[model samples]
Target chain A: MDPDRQSELNALRPDLLRFARLQLRDAGAAEDAVQETLLAALTGSHRFESRSSYKTWLISILRNKIVDTIRSQSRELSASSLADDDAGDDLLDDALFDRRGHWQASARPGRWGDPEASFEQQQFWNVFEACLDRLPAKTARVFMMREFLGLETEEICKETGISSSNCWVVLHRARLGLRTCLETNWFAGAGT
Target chain B: MLSCQRATELMSQEQDRPLSLAERFGLRLHVLICAGCNNYRRQMAVLRAACRRFGSLGGQ
Candidate 1:
């Protein structure tokens, strides 16, 4: 590789690893995926399209590789005698917070009284992360892309290869799942 | 007319910002009649306040 290309790849490595870790949810797998992605980018240097950012292109490759890895593992598991149990019903139950149209109104600013009181309540990010991990892969991916990465809805849809409705559905389900998880585990004691 | 589920979905969306005319009407009408939805809306508001309060903790 050229000196400039080598330097660029080095610069992008940390971000690649971060994105990979988010997708794969394992440090070792993320590192391996990043290594493979960099190697592939180096070999396919001739096909480098200048239309999009190099980071985007590289991340796309990493995402595809991760998906392939997931699918292969799933196939192997399915091929085994073990029947894949259904987790969908549980998720649906969580997401379906209210059958009736009724929902609690948004809390007023002073309702919580002291802001510091709420902050000191607990580390919410841990709860949030746990809830996120329980989401279906595609639902989690869409949620992360939109909420965490701040990607546009259209961009997320394109990246995930889903329709607009599907994107909305995934986001809706993800939000409901997170909300239910928080309400049950985090806020259960508060009586909110 | 929107179903209860659809109204609830729209209500959640409205929490993020000012609702459009249609959404406002839909949400207001639904909340007026649906006690469960009204409670849900209240809970969302509580959650949002909690989130905002927690959001500022980084500087403290």
Candidate 2:
């Protein structure tokens, strides 16, 4: 391998790891995906056409690896029999929203100051990945399957064995949780 | 009347599936009147953009 290319590949590992972990929701599987992606990228380095930035190209490769993982997991086993576990959201919703289904005063979304600025900061991504890591595993997977992988709601519901309503509910929780997490970790002290 | 909770579910569903006319009306009406739900809707938009940023080196 060319030395410069090798070092560049090494530098991309953490970003790739974060992406894989969010997509796979399992550290071991994430590591495998990143490793495989790196290997494939190196082997196919000559094929690079400079059409996209290096990171984007690498992510495209990582995305395929992730899809393969999702496919294998689906074929090998049943959809998460963890549907019963989905009920835990009742506790979360009860505490955060009022009887009338309004935000508890304390739980309303505050202004997120300068989210565009945060997108430029590498540290913001670290916080983003950490918050994503904090979500309940299944919720994170379903959320990524929908948002990151761009899967349809019906496809996510079919894959997760949850009803369309349940799948929507899970996605709702994920968005709320991620927003809260970002607020606490990045936006709160930064300002409105 | 759409509660914040119901409006949010519709907001979420709107992302994946097309909302029925009634559902869109309820969500729009509630969000227009409710600041918190309005903020919640914006927050989800930011979150979606952030996720896309993570996937692409595409500058925002």
On lDDT, the candidate that comes out on top is: 2
Best by DockQ: 2
Chain A TM-score for model 2, please?
A: 0.81
- Residue-by-residue lDDT tens digits, candidate 2, A86-126: 56678868867999898898888777767888888877887
Separate DockQ for every predicted complex: 0.16, 0.61
The residue-by-residue lDDT of candidate 1 on A91-165, one tens digit each, is 454345345432323311112233344445445545644666787665666566565444566665555556555
Model 1 achieves a DockQ score of 0.16
Name the lDDT of candidate 1: 0.57
Provide the interface RMSD of candidate 2 in angstroms, 1 decimal place: 2.5
Q: How far is candidate 2 from the true structure (C-alpha RMSD, Å)?
A: 2.8
Clashes of 2: 0
Give candidate 2 misplaced runs (Cα > 4 Å).
A1-3, A45-52, A74-80, B57-60
Interface RMSD of 1: 7.5
